[model samples]
Target: MSGLLALLDDVAAIAKLAAAQLDDVAGQASKAGVKAAGVVIDDAAVTPKYVTGLPAARELPIVWKIARASFFNKLVILLPVALLLNAVLPWLLTPLLMIGGAYLCFEGAEKVWHLIIPQKDHGPQQAETLDAAHLEEQRVKGAIKTDFILSAEIMTISLAQIEIDTLWIQAAALAAVAIGITALVYGAVALLVKADDLGVLLSVKGRLAATRAFGRRIVKSMPAVMLVIATIGTVAMLWVGGSIIVHGVHDLGWHLPYEQIKYAAKVAAETLGAANGFVTWAVTAGLDGVIGLAVGFILIPIVTRVIAPVTGWLFPEKT
Candidate 1:
């Protein structure tokens, strides 16, 4: 009886310790996740556009595909790469992040270019002529590639939040953060894409008059909502890309831009008084966006003329 009680006591202590470790991991993950919330919002905002113009039935499937790729990007690719870089060459992370930033600037700039130049509209006729599966493939690839950059940023931010020296604990916390953030982002996207379909169903099938009316309103409102989301997503890409470059240069010891932007925001904040906080943020973001746009314009021709052709020749896209 005494021997059994001793063994039981030992097991109970171990269980308690394990539970405590899990609690610590959870706490760390939550804190790290909060740090990456801005990027998380950007990820959520940017993803829905990929599903736009896709078939209603295919929307959820496309979201699922991108979400899966997001998981792989964070866990299999980014997490290991981040840990390796942090351990061996912490200085390299910022440069790599800036490269991704430049790519974002290019993408956003290209979109703006199309808007300004008003490219030949590929309307329903073009969509009908093209193989939709190929289009789907292209969009999925783009989303996944973009997600990789965003996920890298998120993982790096989470890794920075860790004060723990233990490797396993750090890994556990980062993994948790990655999974949690990805789920939240893609889940919200899935909901946004399906909302119209849900509204249609409700409008057609609901028994109550109010419910049907509400559903009809939702159906009516969704197109505008999607447009707004796309606009926000494009602006966010520019803002995020530009902010990354500004901070990247600052990290590389080019402090003038960062300082100037910060100073302007501060002045605006003082002038605005109670609305200072928002005005300050707006100023900072606006300056960052301008920088991003300039970088984008410079890169657009090079990418379109040189990079695009080289890539097309080398890779030869199927569709």
Candidate 2:
């Protein structure tokens, strides 16, 4: 009887430990996911456009396909690479993160530039003649390729934020973040794509007049909502990118900009007595975004004039 009781107690203790570990994994994963929010928002905002012209029936299916590819990119490719890098060359993380950050800044700045000085479509004005299926496939491929880059950034950011000691714990936390972020991004994309359909159906078929009005409003508001999301995504990219670069510079022993930004934020906080936290954050974000925009503008010319030509030469078929 005593032996059986002891065995039972041991099992219970083990179960408790397992539960605690799971909780820790969940908590850490959530924190890591939050840290990668800027990239994640951009991912969600960018993905919806890929399905824009596709058949209504195919929207969710395409989103699912992209989500599956994103999962593979994160779990199968990036997770292992991140772990390998952590184990073999941890110092590489900062440089790699800064690279990703620079990319985000460039992308965000390009969007802003396009908005300011709308580009003339100089390429041959050709209508897309591809079959629907082929078009869908092409879009899916493009989205997945983009997702791969974004997923690499997300995983690296998550890995950087994790503070746990155990290898297995780190792996579990990363996997959780991967699955969670993929679902969150693709799920939001799916809903955004289908929202119009839902609105149309409600507008036409809803029994209540108010319901119909609400549906019409939804249908009307979608474009503006998407615009807002895109704007937010762009801002997030710039803010996060600039902050990363600034911090990276500091880590590399160039602390001038970082110190200046901090000082500015501190001054702003002191000026705003009641809303000190909000003021500080706003000042920090504003400075970071300005830096990001400047960097991005500098990169745009280099990329368009130098990188594009070299890439075209290297991959002539793609050009």
Candidate 3:
């Protein structure tokens, strides 16, 4: 009887330890996910557009397919690569992060520039008779390729944020983040894509007048909501990208910009008193965004003039 009691106590202790480990993994994963919020928000914001002209019935299915691809990109591909990089060339992490940040900034700035000076549609025009299936395939391929880039950024950012010492713990946290983010992004995309349909259905079929009115409001508001989401995503990309570059520079021993931004934030905080925290954050984010815009604009000309032509030349198609 005493021996049996000892075994029970041992099992209880093991169970407790496992539970504690699980808790730690969850906490770390959540922290990492929070750190990658900018990219995650942009992912959610951007994905809905791929389904825009598709049949309503196909929207959710396409999102599901992309989500599946995103999962594979993160877990099977990016996760392993991230772990390898962390284990081997950890020194390269910051530089890689800055590259990703620069890309984000460039994307945000390009969008802003396009808004300011709307580009003429100069490419070959779409056929009057659209091939729905071909279009769907093209969009899906494009979205998955985009997701691969974003997912790489997300995983890299998440890995950088994880502070655990054990490889297993880090792996667990990254896996959790990958799964959670994929689900969150695609789930939101699905809802955003289908919202109009849901609203139309409710507006037409709702038994209650209030429900019908709410549905009508949803239908009317979706476009504006999408616009708002896109705006936020762009801002987030710039802020996050600029912040990453600034921090990366600081890590690499260039502290002037970092110090200047910190000083400005401090001044704002001091002036705001009770709103110190919020003011400080706002100032910091604003400065970061400005830096991002500057960097992006700088890259735009270089990319358009140099990189694009070079890439085309290097990858010339076979006749």
Q: Which candidate gets the maximum lDDT versus the true structure?
A: 3
Q: After superposition, how far is residue 56 of candidate 3 from its true place, in Å?
A: 1.6
Q: How close is candidate 2 to the true structure, as a TM-score?
A: 0.94
Candidate 1, residues 1-319, lDDT tens digits: the string is 9999999999999999989988888988999897566577768878887877778889999999999999999999989988888789978878877887787677777778888898875546656766778778878998997898888878876786777767778889999999999999999999988888889889999999999999999999987987776667667767877887999899999999999999999998997787887899899999998888889999999998999899999998665
Q: Considering summed lDDT, which 10 consecutive residues are worst modelled in model 1?
A: 121-130
Q: Where in model 2 is the C-alpha error above 4 Å?
A: 121-127, 316-319
Give the lDDT of residue 308 in candidate 1.
88
lDDT of 3 by residue, 98-133 (tens): 999999999899989999999986323442245778
True-structure RMSD, every candidate = 3.7, 2.0, 1.9
Clashing pairs in 1: none
What do the candidate models score in CA lDDT, each in turn?
Answer: 0.85, 0.91, 0.93
**Ten contiguous residues minimizing lDDT sum, candidate 2:** 121-130
**TM-score of structure candidate 1:** 0.81
For residue 312, model 1's alpha carbon misses the true position, in angstroms, by 2.1
Which portions of model 1 miss their true places by more than 4 Å?
Answer: 1-42, 49-55, 121-142, 157-166
